[model samples]
Target: MFHQPNSEFAVVCRFQGLFPDDIGGYEKHRTRNGGDLGHVDASRSHLNRRVIGNADWAARTIAMIEDMKAENFADEIETLTRRRRKKQLKHRMVEGPRDPWRATRHGPMREVILTANRNWFDAPATSAARAARAQAFEDAARDWLLANFGEDVVHARADLDEQAFHIHAVIVPKVQVELNGTTRWMLQPSKHDLIKNYEAAQDSVGQHFAPLGLARGERRAAAVRKARQTGDEPPAYRQHVRTADWRKAEDTKIVETRAELEQRAEAMIVDEIVLAQREAGMIARENAIEVREQAAAGRERAAETKEQEADAMLAVGQGLAAGAFDIEDRDGTPALVETPEAKPGLLSKLRARMALSSSGRARALHVFSKALARLRKQSRDEAKTAVARDTAEIEAADEKIVEIASRLPDAERRSIGKIRLSLSARIMALTGRNMARETPERGGNDGRP
Candidate 1:
């Protein structure tokens, strides 16, 4: 018999950046604290174990990584400190860049989460095979991480108390770079380059777990490519959804919408100005051409008096060449030489500018269309969610009502049924939906059906 692929037990590998100051906070969260942590089950907290290093060990490991071919950035650090102090003196809140040591967008320490589905780790207390499977998977994952990241994997831990069984490893991507004829250490995550090409990293993780019969999850790149081909937005994965992240995305969208409206208004004004300038240029060109013709006519009359008919005819011919011809003296004779087709006029220039603006508007329209489609999809999804929640709540309330009614005396139950019928009638009247009438068989043990 053919068995289905264990796609649900696919390997998950993700990398996140953390600043120097955030490392201690992560340690506190991963380790034990005395207070009641909402998500944690304190009874099973003892089961949580450190697979590798602790906070002190991680700090020391980072120091070692920094010491290897390290570059002195004391001046830069001092300057940053002075700036912070100055801001503090002014009572202004200072927001530091992601990487304070260098001009990088990501922090130095990388947080690597390695895990599979929750179902893979779940097992009964006496099920030796299932328990062994969980242990084996964790062992393989930890070994694979250490082998791949080597010394960069500073801290690794397993938190079994949470909803899932996963290993968290801190990787400090400190690579040696040859700068100015010297090998210097730099906090560069590109040395691993997992964040940029996470799909490939996921593939690698999946291959490592192949012996355990676990496949890889859906590749994000594939989904993105398919979406692009279809002119549709890629589906959002549940794992990537966080409340703060969602809010940030919403705020960004609002800002972008405002910016787009401003741009459209600016474009409209530009088009109006360009059109006015074009119209003015056309009128000016017409006037100039008319005057040139009048001047040519007057010159023709003078040529007739002086009997220079050839020059007169030539002047008329040149004037009709749409302002392209110019008269020049060639060997003591006046001859027409075509000037390089006359430079494009102000009208032509304005037309060209308007063409560019039209293209920009077209692009903006395309973006607006995409945003509209996304909003429509979001509205539909939210409506479905709301309906589901309402239905579940109503069903739960109905069950409670039936339980309460069953405990009541026969007289009281009959009275309650009358009240329920009146309430249902009122609700149906307001909603314009017909409410089903109760039959004798459907009614309780009372003569009120």
Candidate 2:
């Protein structure tokens, strides 16, 4: 009923202890809590299908080993004890009751792990195809066990619940012994020595599966011979690493690596934000410096203009002091002359002095008015600049708040949004106050000149 296995596939046959004392925990794990193991996916446990064998490993062991022992060996043991008593009475010899099938040295059961190459079954993914492959393997393995070990194979189970489909066959090692006028089967693991003849067992199983293209693994003897030829020691047999432990370690590494990556990413983000803030601060400082330079240049220009006006007023006063009028003959008529060197008459001097005083007062008054206007304009410009800078900073803060709020939970985001709105309102009020204060109507500066 089994399909031909791919030639590339190989079979695995491992023998290990499955003692009577270990059966309770083993049965619970295999039957009930298999999903709790690392290799098993609890969510896909529904896909796990049992091929054969009952859940009561303990009962099965008792029935096959202890019960059989009591049934067949009880009378023989009693008779042997009676004989031993008579022998002890006749001779000075140490005699004890015969317990031939005692299980003191070795347990009654040993487990065999049987499976084809894992890839053969796992390659096919579709439900029907995968099921067929699993069924074929199970059937072949079951038949092989029955043919090779007979009734000694007390329990056979195929587990499709782990990483791969495999079969566990429980075998009781026993042999027929002829002694003390009776023939009986007795527990004798040392005589059978299945674990000692592991290579032979693998070879036998491999031969059975040869028609299906399954091949045996390399022999230890062959490996030893090869090692001798190469002038090296024979390789030591290594124990199988548990799939659960391997997977757990790998998962832990993956989690740790992922967490490290996340932390690095967060750190990078924070660094970029800090850099951007620093750049913004630099830009603001540069802008303020430019504004101050511009205001200073304006003040310098105003000072130069005032100096020139003062010089012009002084020149007028000097001309008025020199003379008010100059007399010169032109076409035989008398003409008044105004010059720096011309001497003034008493009446002319009086007129010039009165005129100079009146002009001086007006010029001084005009200069004072112009200076006041310039000062007022400078103050207004400074106030406007301050208001603009504050407004820009407030807007920037609002934008930052919005960006941060976007990452928060809905409730927290809503609360932050309310705060942002209040901040915006306050900013608006501040802007209004700045604007009102800067206005001429607020009496900050009136352009009287």
Candidate 3:
């Protein structure tokens, strides 16, 4: 029976570097249909007008980064410690010709286009049904982005104007992470991480759309493994040969016995299972290490935040005492005050005045201390919770590791035995066939081509 075409989901992930010179071109392509520049194709246009969420702010953002770097270079140099200055000089010397605009290897933005097999939408008879399918696909794409990248997803647009309906998303690489007991923003997720996330997103999209008759696309590795097990030419190889030619060639080759073929297939299956188990063990160890490191970092951040808050409160109290004063107005009402010349502005003056009175200062300090204390307590609590969660995760991973390790040896041995048996039987059959064929041609022991 002929089966219906499966709706397969795919995500094409590309990281285009927003160089200083290429920014204009990218911006043009994103904003307008290039007339003579040919940045965008107008011939196959389906869009009547600009769609929502199709703005080109990424180039502008990259330009802002460049401008900030240039403007702050002197300030950065002045603030750097002696050791830091030396390290910076060394890095600049070693890493030659760095692009000011491209901060990371994958640059500042990531573009992911999520599309599915065209047949999925084309098969719908009604325009409303087609629109529904398109909306479903876009929704799935948006969900994948939010789940994977969270706030890092800068912009996402569903472009029905394209030949195939797809969602185009731009993601900034910035992420807030705790490093050395401090929360800081950094450009995260290298190209490798992006690819990993993309692969995971593809799986999620498949799961999300599964009820709607969409399936995940087959992975290249899985396809290769299947081809190996089947002992047939893979799709890549089939591209070079016609089906009729391939069939005729296969007919001329000596076929293995059904029993031997079955044994070999079983051996391959067992081998694959054992390999998978080993991989699972390795992944478990890696996860355990990652979780432990995260827990350690969390504890450090909590401690650091507590220390920083204590220091800040102490400084505020010291500053208030050193700057305390009193001023009597024309009405002879004594009011706590700060020297107007000493303070920067009205806000600073008000703050200083509030800190001058013993009662007001004490109340303000108490409120400040309470807030900091609450923050510190929350940090500690979160750290503890993280530790507990990760601990459980690691323990479960360890159990899986142990279970897989225990079963792997026996599985490997059985697979090896089957493989040897299959090989020996195939060799014997080949020899017997050669002998039988030679017997008929043995009329003369003459050498022939």
Candidate 4:
């Protein structure tokens, strides 16, 4: 059901093309990975690798090595990957020592990293069990990297401590001729390209277990959705960056906009005043007649009612009345206060507020119970949301990885690469012909897709 794994782990891989001795090249490339995050190599392999059984030993070895050397892979790989859709921009994260410090660099070193990870993980039952699981993942990762990139990977090993598990690979680009005497350009795959290959490898791994009734695809999908909603996320700047200044700027813009609006309102008011001026005389004459008629109607009502409630009079023609009536009197009561009584503190003359009346106290407990129930419900909702987020992220990562991998060049799919090239050439040739046939007055556009 799946073409690749939606793994809840991050992996890194680096590759360097071999240099011939005749080219005045040295062993610098072999030692490059060792210098990367040195702590990874400092661990005693005998003890760590022994933690896992033979069945998972290879998996554990690779995971540990990858974790150690990940730093050398590249910085801000996830950021770069996310920005890929922008098309026009290459996400280059500028880092290093601040103004005063800088690290030494040998040769013109450049690298692109491809990282794969899900946001959630399976919990361990015991320390030994956790160690065994870790060992298995690392071991498998080691073999995976060598098998995909080549056996020459033994020359590189990075030490990232235990911060994360990722592979580091290095390859210096140079031209070389194959046995067929065809000279080819040496190059490191782009980040997008490398991830494609990695995902393809994972697809192969998943299929091998299919006959054993192990279905990886479905499990990965469910786990990914669960991880996404649980907030088991990779580090993202949205969580860390503050937008207060942006909001403040937006408020200022609104204030300025309101000032302009006020000017517009003043103009509108003036126009309204002018319009009223044009209609004022006719409007006043009509209103006067209305008032006179209303007055006559009110007098008729007053004469009819007599003295039952002397101060009351019937409403006249919807507030067009000219006749006045007496106001009611409630002269003895104290005037009502508009302000609330303030609570006193310290040595103020006002008496203290009682902690609570018996009924008030009982009501307070009822309110507390309601609040507690609400809080519990809120907590459950939050937990559910977090789990869903984690799950989504994992699913997205898996699908993207698989799609890229399916397009990569693998052992059985090497011929697929030729197919891609042939198709691309045919497409380009047809496109050129179409463009040539089109009128110059018309232009190409994005609606094509």
Question: Candidates' lDDT values, in order?
Answer: 0.58, 0.62, 0.50, 0.35
Clashes of each: 0, 4, 0, 50
How would you encode candidate 3's per-residue C-alpha lDDT over 114-157 as one tens digit per residue? 66666766768888878887776666667767776776676676
Per-residue lDDT for 1-449 in model 1, tens only?
A: 10234665787777877876566667677765532256576788888777876548756864564334112222222333345554432221111111223565567778888777777666335567666776777788788887777777778888778667778888877776665444446677767755557887888888878777678877778898899899999877657644246666887899677656655677778577668768997998999999899989987886554333333332333232344333333344333333455445632543343243443323222222232233345445655566566556655766677689889999998888787767655644633321121101112222121
- By TM-score, highest first, what's the ranking? 2, 1, 3, 4
The lDDT, on a scale of 0 to 1, for candidate 4 is 0.35
lDDT of 2 at 336: 31
* Worst 10 contiguous positions by lDDT, candidate 4: 316-325
Candidate 3 Cα deviation (angstroms), residue 143: 1.9
Off by over 4 Å in 3: 1-23, 35-56, 67-108, 176-186, 191-194, 225-449
lDDT of 2 at 379: 64
Residue 278 error for model 2, in Å? 35
Model 1: which ten-residue window has the lowest total lDDT?
Answer: 89-98
Residue 246 of candidate 1: its Cα lDDT? Answer: 64
**Would you estimate the TM-scores of all the predictions?**
0.44, 0.48, 0.40, 0.23
Q: Listing every candidate in turn, what is its Cα RMSD in Å to the true structure after a full C-alpha superposition? A: 38.0, 49.1, 38.8, 42.8
Which candidate model has the greater TM-score, 1 or 4?
Answer: 1
Better of 1 and 3 by TM-score: 1
- lDDT (10s digit) by residue, model 4, range 1-449: 21234343334333232222211222232223322233333453323222112333334433333322222212222323334523211212111101111232222122222222312112456666545544454545455444544532322332233234333443322222232222222222332233336345446444443332223332344455667888685333232221245555677899677656655677778577557755985797899899899989987876654321211111110011111111111242211111112222311221111121332222222222232233345445655566566556655755665576587768535565565557556655755454444312211232110
Predicted candidate 2 versus true structure: per-residue lDDT over 1-449, tens digit per residue: 34465568888887766566567666666666533476765676575555445656558765455434433433453344446654432221111112246555446457878887677777776878878877777778888877777777767777776778888877777777776676666766556544558777878888877765678766777788899999999989766665667787898899677656655677778577668768987997999999899989988996766555444444333332344322233454322335444445644544444354453334533322232334356667778888888889988988999999999999999999998898799878979887776755312122111
Which pairs of residues collide in candidate 2?
A: 325-337, 326-336, 326-337, 327-337
